[model samples]
Target: MSIAIIGPAEIEAMIDREVADYPTDTRAGAQTLEAFQNARRKPRLVSVNFSGGITQKCYSVTRPNGDYRVIYLPLAGYFSLCVESDFGPLDIGVHGPAIACFGSV
Candidate 1:
């Protein structure tokens, strides 16, 4: 699979769409916004899981809404941003790797 890099502008646009999808006042909507903001600050790789010999790095941030976890596949240039809210888990998965390469930044 080819990895496509995602730019900051594209990420912001995605967050804007997500925020628009729900009313800001609502808990779900608020959490979505919070998640986006937290992600905007600084995304860090918190852990690397090697379960069953399959490696997976979890990038995360802590927010008022909840803990946001980013599942980014450097090789595939794909990523999924998510948060656990009162309603459930809010997630955005995208496939795009511009500067596609493996390992942490």
Candidate 2:
């Protein structure tokens, strides 16, 4: 299979779709928010500098196969993923709730 590369606009759209999945009025939504808050309490996560003075949460996960980074912005209600690339850290459009982003690790 061939690889496909997407641009910033497409990434933004994916993030929008992921964030739209949960409604704040529902129990699932509440759980999502709680999960993010719980992640914030942990020290395993790292801090990254974001635009507009926002400190985004990040964690570098390593496995025998490869490595990837997870990012969370609680105020924005979303999470993202990044992988080390030949050029630099390449962000893959992985926007979603806390459990969906951080539960596996």
Off by over 4 Å in 1: 7-13, 25-28, 31-40, 56-58, 61-70, 73-105
lDDT of candidate 2 at residue 70, scale 0 to 100: 53
- CA error at residue 42 for candidate 1, angstroms: 2.0
Model 2 alpha-carbon drift over 4 Å, by segment: 31-99, 102-105
Q: What TM-score does each of the candidates earn?
A: 0.36, 0.33
What is each predicted model's overall lDDT from 0 to 1?
Answer: 0.42, 0.46
As a whole number from 0 to 100, the lDDT of residue 7 in candidate 2 is 38
Q: In angstroms, how far off is 83's CA in candidate 2?
A: 11
- Candidate 2 lDDT over 1-105, as tens digits, reads 553543334444544564566467988767764554443322234555543544444443312114454554434445555454544334456656533654333
Give the number of the best model, judged by TM-score: 1
Cand. 2 Cα-lDDT? 0.46
What is the alpha-carbon lDDT of model 1 when measured against the actual structure? 0.42
